[model samples]
Target: MWHVIIFFWLLYYLIKPKYSRRSLYPPGPLALPLIGNLLSVWLGLKKYKYHHKLWQSWSQTYGNILGLRLGSINVVVVSGKDMIKEISSREVFEGRPDGFLYTMRSFGKKLGIVFADGRSWMNTRRVALKYLRNFGYGTRSMELIITEECLELVKLRKTDAGQPILVNQMFNISVVNILWRVVAGRRYDLNDDRLKRLCALVMRLFRLVDMSGGIISFMPFLRHVIPGLIGFTEMKSIHSSLQAFIKETIDEHRASIDVKNPRDVIDAFLMEMSTNQENAFTEEELHVVCLDMLEAGMETVANTAVFMLLYLVRDEGVQRRVQKEIDDVIGKRQPSLGDRSRMAYTEAVILETLRLSSVAAMGVPHRALDDAHLGGYLIPKGTCLLMAIHDLHNGEFWEDAGTFKPERFLTKEGNIIQDERLMAFGLGRRRCIGEGLAKSELFMFLTHILQKFFIRIPDGDPPPSLKPVDGLTLSAKPFRVIFVER
Candidate 1:
């Protein structure tokens, strides 16, 4: 029958490359005929909270930079901070792949900032940064916006004090509101049903990317044949829902757009579209860009805050020290950005949290624009590159890297030291566009929460596992906390 013929054809097509073109690639496990190293790589990540475990184990035998064959594509993972930093900065390595899922998510084109490359990415990033600054990206106004939201978060927690509460979800409202204000010129109420749905959908989308090393991201073809098996159906539904929401927001901005008087990121983007007809900024692109920023901003900081709280919950001494630091520096009045420099311990806690739990453990997939040499290995153009940040952080970069010691980021003079090794937001042109805003928001939220409440494990329940759940972000499992009033 035709089915058997097609099966043989696919087998021959997949197996052909292993015999002929395997020599040019960097050394990895000898891939099997047709499937390559797909099964091993997939099975390797099936059991861990962080995918870096699998890569770190492989890097020992194959050097810091080694390639793996996933399906028909070749992927190179870079370990250790030095190699990750070098590979991440290369201009030739700045391009993104045209994989089915990558393109499909961005409306069948690399239209937005996250999955885009070349001139489109360049133009969009430049314009977005410029206008986002005008909208209070790194200024005191931004700090105030975040602080205001933090107050809402505190109020919400106070309402449910001493109850078994999912602190991460509560943090979600405040974090989303800050970005919502900056990007959309408005803030959703903490109890708004729309805000909750939007945040949940975005979180689910990222979690899908974490399962089985995000098999669907590169192997999107499986979705066509076996959507349920591959998680493509859920991903598509979430994307469609998010897209519709973004479209409505953009349409609202379009109707009320003023040339001289821009409101937020949406209006600013519209103004740019009005003038820059030649660039890649379009209505569809705007939706993706908004979603990109929203998706990046919402869960990352919240998850981090939860991680910090997990540490605080487990280590009461450190928790008391953080609170004491907050008390000495900022007192009872809302913690401001100005207090950050003096609160070295609090700053170190944030830095350490980022180091220990790198939310985006693997940097977004980077594709080679042309044949390139790295660590003596030739990476062919279109080869995918991954930054195993877990290995990078756990390597020789930090003394006692396995421990949760914030003092590593502190000096003898009690000042916070800035290490280039702490690359949670990444490096170079493709680094997180909202890093400035995110840092501001994160600092404010953590300080404000610690100032008002003591984060503790819930009563009459077994202590939940401290190991983070594997996802696009390394996050605490859904464990409840009792926020005892300070």
Candidate 2:
């Protein structure tokens, strides 16, 4: 009798015209009683290619900026570029949404530049920007580091000697080297145990966080009650390993601090901590910030390089053009940041790769703090906004959006034309702080590798399916490539 009553109540709620107040918001499939539209969205959890397909279908049926209930939680997916701009620019929508996974991971503490909001985010971002600028992000200091890493990458690939190499591994090593230099002022050995463990833990955490149907995300209390139900044990183990690694590194930096000159990110952070003891920034913040920087920097750059490799293997013509340009301008020597202007085709290829492959498919979600309007729709405060980067890469916004033609980026007269619609690093005030570093890393590494080796699908294997793996970051599936020495 009680079950019947509850069922009828839920039915009534579903049929009721409660959401009529916000009818102007984009339309979507009618959410059912308790489960809502979660079942439909969660259908492609196992296969990555289907995940984006599901979202695309939803947008096609409902219009851009559609709303749905993910097991009682409101999920607003903004597909259009104009809507993304409006939402991301507003303070009301500038904050990240509260989730069980985030709370558990950080224990409600916003440490890294990625999760920190408002004052902390602003302060940390400003500090990081200042430090990166001084460290030669736009200048020549960091470019030297990138060039060295690329050189090391080429040597490493040479060892494989025209055989299929897992390009992802090489990309990971190069990215980790760049990150290690920025954080600790030195690069790690290719076989460093600590670096390997750190990378593994980060990859695991990313997988856990990206999974859509995690119980912890919806039911925070389950973290305490059911424990195993939320995968808290694994989460706790990974967090402990990462936290310990960060704490030890920071302590080492503290012991070796040279007041006359700061070394790396740690040295700069310690200097700030010494001057500003009263503020919220603490040793704990420093530890988490280092962890955040490593995780964010590694995953983004590695996935990007992997995507570029996939494209090169799949399209021989595009590969040949880029390689020809590299050979003409850079010759046998490794490419450097200084060579970026001379290598226009290579630069355009990088841009086109970012466009064709949407790495950060649905960018970090933002919450609106105040009422805002975008794309003929009024977005109320507290509304969650999702920027669909994948949609932007396909829509009519760019000429020949479907094609992987780098020539589109080149002017009719053969000049590189910058396109603002490429928001892989995101847009507005909250754009990626490490954009300069990431750009340099991608350009130099790709040029160096292509110059020395020709990448092709492994013998007896079909061309790597350009399909991306699903996660918070859209990663490429494991594929091998033959590196024929140039």
Candidate 3:
């Protein structure tokens, strides 16, 4: 009798529905036991190639707040602008997920700002922002550094002005060097082989991340079961190489120490670690923080710039209009941060690029710190919250949502309009810390390039495809452009 009862229990467990018909969670498709919605998500990814698109498709059936269970994890995808803002602003929903992929990046534990949560995350984020700001992040002083790098890029590209050159990774070195200056007190030459390798590693890192956090993130046992076949080895190798590089840089900073005069962000962090004993500011934390800076800053800014250029090249009329604006205000003069105000059309172009490209398609996943109600449904504690950012930008709020129209962000009076619906940098507490620096770089780099060159599609070549190569961030497909000197 005991054996029969045990057998029935086991069978029920294997075939049970993860979400019952009378569940309080938001309405969603049926989720199977153990696997839950993994198979459906996988199929969606195979069809759409982007998580935001997949979630948008489901939202059509289940309304804005769609719920699901991927293995043992409960996920709530919040679409619609108002609902996204609600979740983004709530304190109870600011936690980051502590899954295997997140911890694996920080040595088998959550340690950095991007993945860590609670008190430690709060402290690290506070310190990082304070120090990064002190080192000229989002400041006028940093504008000069970006200007210098923009000049270098302009000089390098001048050599191939008439020839078709691949522009996909063109902005990587300049963008990374700008952040490196703040983080490490140095910059890399555009041709540095080390910079090339580092950029490759960063690129590979983004590709490894699945829109649904990968199979290993949910089924972590796969690492132990089929480590070689399941990309575990490659992932580990990439992370180890990146950490080693950051460690080497930190060691050099330690050798040439200056406590009183903090040379850069690393110096500031080191000083904090030395003096503040209460926080979880360790050497490992420092390494991971620096890695976070590079990976986060490099991919977002570089790819967005490339995407901006891709759009401009495809639309010569738009390109000419922007150049006209650049010519009208600050023509042939170096573009300072102040110039950004008078250049409304140029600002609109940047805004349109961010809205259309939506590099961070899903943005970083947020976790529910406590069980809470959103969109008339219960989000249990430990549920992963995915803010459908791409959907928000392209959904009902905007007219001609799919078209690349900078004018959509502009008013009839020739002024830039600030639409709250465009949450490209995300919203609330976990909003990207590099937003200010990113905007500065985009304005300066784009203005400088447009002031000097006219980006054109090469003769006899087809127009570049607007379709993005999807991954962690939406990347522009490989294409070449001729930078004709104006």
TM-score, every prediction: 0.92, 0.89, 0.94
| Candidate 3: stretches off by over 4 Å | 1-22
Best by lDDT: 3
- lDDT tens digits, residues 1-486, model 2? 999999999988886654653675556777777666756656645443455556767787778877766664566777777767766676667876666666455656765678667887788878876766665556777778788878877787787787767666556657877767877887887667777777877766766654332456555666778876557778889888888877788888999999779988788888988887777467777776777777888988888888888888888998999888888888876577888888888889889988888777777777665666666665666555677788888677777786778888898878898876788888878788778788888898788888888888877987777777666777777788988987
lDDT of each: 0.80, 0.75, 0.87
Measured on C-alpha atoms, candidate 2 has an lDDT of 0.75
Cα distance off (Å), candidate 2, residue 130: 1.9
The TM-score-based order of candidates, best leading, equals: 3, 1, 2
Clashing pairs in 2: 92-368, 92-369, 92-370, 93-367, 93-368, 93-369, 164-481
Per-residue alpha-carbon lDDT of candidate 1 for residues 351-394, written as tens digits (9 for 90 to 100)? 89888877777867788999888887778888888888766666
Report the C-alpha lDDT of model 3 over 166-196, residue by residue, as the tens digit. 9988999999999999999999999899888
